[model samples]
Target: MKTIIYCWLFLFIISFNLYSIKISVGEADISLRLTDTDFTIDNYNFDPPIKETYSVEWEAIDNMTYIKFNYTGQAMGEKIARGEKRYLVLFSK
Candidate 1:
């Protein structure tokens, strides 16, 4: 009986840890339990006819997610922007 209960508990813990969740923003999807710290964002609405790719760094603290992003690619054969943006987003499970 004890071995059966231990097996059941192990399965429960494994199943909980294997769960995956994601948050979608526009055309981007972010993982809730992300193993990677960086992601890329692509903007399709550009006036210069070039899509811009932004490199974003993310971190989670407490119940909020912190994000910082900057333009890291060229647009229309030129640099897109020269600024960094930060955001603190609240999420709930």
Candidate 2:
């Protein structure tokens, strides 16, 4: 029973790690992370900086995957020099 429990725990950890993605630019103070169902971005280049996380919706089409999410943070609008934006991200195996 103990062995079975340990095995399951190990598998869970491995599965979680397999589906997680992280990207960082050297000395840019910008990073992005995507998990199984969530997406996050951290950018410290703005006047007030920006760090927000939004739920991700994904769809599989042909050999590619599409990820969509909305950002309603301080970095939005014309005053900040960035207007309403839409991003199309594609992920392929």
Candidate 3:
């Protein structure tokens, strides 16, 4: 009985690790964690500096539209000068 319970627990842990995501940049860090205890986000931001700029985007992806919103602790605006750093962490509806 003990062996059966242990085996089931191990399998459950493996399944939880598959649907998790973590995003960050070199100096900037961001975390979007959902605390349902059903899904896990385990450092899926395997890369740094994930810049998804819509500088000249003609339309949205999958027929989606993004309206105005704000992201605290993040730089969310167009460039005024030369290179520095920008980070946006919100895509609201």
Q: Which structure among the candidates has the greatest lDDT?
A: 1
Task: Name the lDDT value of residue 82 in candidate 3.
Answer: 23
Q: What RMSD, rounded to one decimal, does every model reach?
A: 15.2, 14.0, 17.8
Q: Which stretches of candidate 2 lie over 4 Å from their true place?
A: 1-18, 23-35, 75-93
How do the residues 5-59 of candidate 1 rate in per-residue lDDT, one tens digit apiece?
Answer: 0001111122547523354544555443333444455555455544444455666
Cα lDDT of model 3 overall? 0.24
Error of 3 at 85 (Å): 15
Off by more than 4 A, model 1:
1-47, 60-64
lDDT tens string, model 2, 40-72?
A: 455565566664444455556786545544443
Candidate 3 stretches greater than 4 Å from native: 1-18, 25-70, 74-93
lDDT values of the candidates? Answer: 0.45, 0.38, 0.24
C-alpha TM-score for every candidate: 0.44, 0.37, 0.19
Tell me the tens digit of each residue's lDDT in model 3 across 1-93: 000000010111225564222433233333322332221112223332122221211123465532211221212343222222223323422
